[model samples]
Target chain A: MKTLETTLRSLRESGRKALVPYVVAGATPDWTHHVEAAVLGGADAVEIGIPFSDPMMDGVVIQEAGLRALERGTTFESICQELESLETEIPLVAMTYYNIFLHYGLRRTAGRLHDVGVSGAIVPDLSLEESDEWRAASGDSDIATIFLVAPSTSRTRMRTVAGLSQGFLYASARMAVTGAASDQGEGERVVSELRRVSDIPTYVGIGVSTPAQAHTTAVFSDGVIVGSALVKIILQGASPTDVESFVRSFRTALD
Target chain B: MDEINAMGQPDHRGHFGGFGGRFVPEALMPACVELEEAFRDAWSDEEFVALYHRTLREFAGRPTPVTPLPRLSQRLGLRIFAKREDLAHTGSHKINNVIGQTLLTQRMGKTRVIAETGAGQHGVATATAAARLGLGCTVFMGEVDTKRQELNVFRMELLGATVVPVTSGSKTLKDAVNEAMREWVTCVADTHYCLGSVMGPHPFPWMVREFQRVIGAEAAWQLKELGVDVPDAVVACVGGGSNAAGVFAGFAETAAQLYGVEAAGGAAVTSGSPGVLHGMRSLILQDEFGQVEEAHSISAGLDYPGIGPEHAHLADTGRATYVAVGDDEVIGAMRLLSESEGIIPALETAHAVAWMVREAGGRLPTGSTVLLNLSGRGDKDVAQVRAMLMEES
Candidate 1:
């Protein structure tokens, strides 16, 4: 399987920005359908959120989605088993809180994710200063570790995070949690600042909902990650076709 | 075990025997690092220590007197002294920790403070401290808590702090914490999360405990003056365990037995599984898959799914004995104390009183001396208690 770095590098070479759409695993029993739709909509990568009861980084929309997923008996083992059947070619990155890995045995969970076709992982709660154990566990499985750079991040810390992140640097468009509207100027400035510090492929997430916002964010970064917006659509009882069309619009805009 | 004790807690990476660590999101990392550094510097500074005590003495009322509950002690056949933390300015033990944290917030050059409150004592204390310290303050309370604790909500607003009503996820303390942390992520640059208890991440459990330790220190000196070298047992109610941890820290190495009383409806220490929640790995009410479970209690303050990590560590090491008291028992105990000693204890603190009522006669040795922490007054709980009493009648 190609690594996340290779895919982002390829997208850059092709003169196209990447589209990474996020959907919560087990949001419904057929949650895998959302991943298939995002991939079919021309997404270069996908982020599958493993539901946690207390997601401090998430807004109301994502929190509701996770609650629903948990009510449907979604477990990490169930998600991994379901991922093995996913036929998408794009790299799938698992986005979760650090406790999930700590509970599941980090090294063991990393190997399981690798076996099930997950190419990378993003633990928003695991800061760069506290990620040594996570990095070591995931490194053995050749699973790339993605780190986030926020507006509140210092320049020195930004350099450290950028240097350590294996796949790509996640640039949070705003200081707020996920699902709020992105400020175009702030989004552009954060991406520009990230670009100035490192040449690593940067994807701006958190409140990049609309095609216009995605387009504005993509102009300053290598890619854009849409999470709460897509999760909202899915939670609002949208069909798989609706999800595909929604993702396709962003793909077209990015193109 | 000896080597672990010699190394002395948290072991540099902030693990209280696999209970506490920095499990917050990446956005809060720099803020956490900054807060930890600022705490280390200010905590050791003589000026900071002197000022903190001076404020307590002058503004918040320190060295709260210990009252001997002779009637209740005679009934139970055991001698008891109540440390009167409920007599503090804000009517609870919460003010001590807030005074320290609000000062540290100023020291860190942050001008705003955010906190989550369950029973509203912490909210009232934070609002009071922020007003005194001349800083902006915001308090998040669950929608359910707001309805039950409406007077406290109004009190916080009247004290010049904004109270945000969170309507998510069971609408209780845990949800309030979730909302507060979400708000802190965005405003961490100039805002400090004035955590109400000895829980969450590294520096919090340690820092809050230190601020609260003065309670035990005061109690010990007062007890010694009364010619009591060491009480048979030192007891306090546990709700996220700030007061308990504070009081326990004083008697940790002493011969006094440490006892923590948990609400039967929310006995995380006695009936919970060890798992990670709210940035700490501690005993929590979680299912097999690690999803946090909602805890239930008539006392909103004790209605939480998780306890402080230090309490969990103490439980594991047998340094403390944890027990549970039911709602009915607490209500009866509250009435007994009020009728006998002219003290209406907060329902959270009444849990400890209830445990003593149930176990003092048979379980404890005759003539045993017990030091119980009266964590808070019952003024805020009068409306809720009245309703509960009406229901019982």
Candidate 2:
């Protein structure tokens, strides 16, 4: 399995903008196929969401998708078991609220994710000041603890987040959760702030939905993370081929 | 006594003995950090303190009397006194927290405030504060709660606040809170999230408790004035445990034993384990998979699956005890208070009354002097209680 930092850093060093697609692990019975579709769609890394019952930070679309996924009996253990069947060599990052991991036992979760070939995690609700224990435990298992930087973040904290963030820095495009957007959002500005702080593999997310938005974000962000837009497609019963096409559009825009 | 220890504050970084900490999204970390700094500065500034007290005094009605519950005390064979927070403006102790947050909102130059409410006491209080201070108010409540609490929705609207019905998740207080956090992120630059309870990330659990400690502080002095120094027990109902924490704050150093009553179905401290929710690590009612379960209660205010972080810590260290009462008992307790003392307590507050009735001679001594925090008026719950009575007959 590819390590998150090695793959993303190599992509950045080679001047190729990265494209990461996100999908809920159990949004569909064939959700793993959707992950496979992203691989086929030219994704450099994939973020898999372990659906949580109360996703405090997600917008409506993702929240609905999570409810659907959880109704189908998706759990942290269930999601990890399914990842074993995945054939992707690219680094896989799991995203969810902090409670899921804190409840699952941090070291056990980190070790299990590593065993399943997962490279990093995006526990959005875990702030930098409270991430020390998780970071150390995840780091011991070679599982990167990804941190997010927002437009509202002060420069000093941005520097702190960048210094502690392993694998990559998840740069929020705007001060909003994962959802749809009409304009390019704050992707460019936040990415620039992150760029000034350090040369970490920063990916702009939260509202990078459309192909044009992805294209714009890629111009400044080292990577563009397309989440809700792709999850919305899968939740709407898009076939693996259709899901591939959706991700391919963002991939094409990045290229 | 030194006031700081009397009303405990969290660590400089907001750790309430390993429970309360900032666990919000990075997008809100700056806002949380800013709130912490502002709270510390304002809480210490005599002018801000004076203004907070003045608003509570002249505007919201402070120093709510500590009344003796003679009839119920006679029946239960216990010496009982009730701290009448129900007499405060807006009919609940929730007004105290909102008044403080709304004032801080203006001080921070924020022009709008957003809040989450379950049964709507907090929302009504926030709307009231916002209207008084001339700030925009948007309250997020669960779609289900909005239907059941239409009057509160109308009340907020009448107060010039927009009430957005949250339709996601369980469509209840838990989901309303989720929706509120999502909304806060989008407007954190110009809005304050006026959290209702002593929950949420750092400063909130600590901050709200500080605002509410006035309840305990006043009752402590009032009891002394009544020649009752240091009651045998101090009791209050626990939702996110603001009232309990507040009252406990005044008597934590006292010899009085503190009891926080929880609805049996929503007894986080009584039956829950350590977990994270609403941006704090506390005792949360969750399934085996760590998914938080929906709390059930007759009162909308106490229908939460978690207790406040400080409550969790207090429960851990044995500084205070937590107990649970049934909905049926809460209803009976409400009626007993109404007929016995001409005081109708909110269903949420009746949990404490119910526990006192059951434990007065069982767990507690028959003649012990007990102080109960009457956290809210029963006017909002009378209709629900009426329907329940009719159904039972």
Q: For this target, which candidate reaches the highest lDDT against the unseen true structure?
A: 2
In lDDT terms, how accurate is model 2?
0.90
Top candidate by DockQ? 2
Q: What does candidate 2's lDDT look like per residue over B1-393, in tens digits?
A: 246563477787687787989889988988998998898889999999899999999999897999998899999999999999999999989999999999999999999999999999999999999999999999999999999999999999999999999889999999999999999999998999999999999989999999998999899999999999999999999999998988999899988999999999999987898888989989899999989999999888889999899998888888899999998888888889999999999999999999998897887798999999999999999998898889989
What are the chain B TM-scores of all models? 0.97, 0.98
Tell me candidate 2's TM-score on chain B.
0.98
Candidate 1 per-residue C-alpha lDDT over A39-73 given as tens digits, one digit per residue, 9 for 90 to 100: 99989999999999888889999999998998888
Model 2, runs deviating above 4 Å: B4-7
lDDT of 2 by residue, A221-248 (tens): 7888889999887878899999888888
iRMSD, all candidates:
1.4, 0.8
RMSD of each: 2.7, 1.3
For each candidate, give its TM-score against the true structure.
0.94, 0.98
Q: Which candidate leads in TM-score?
A: 2
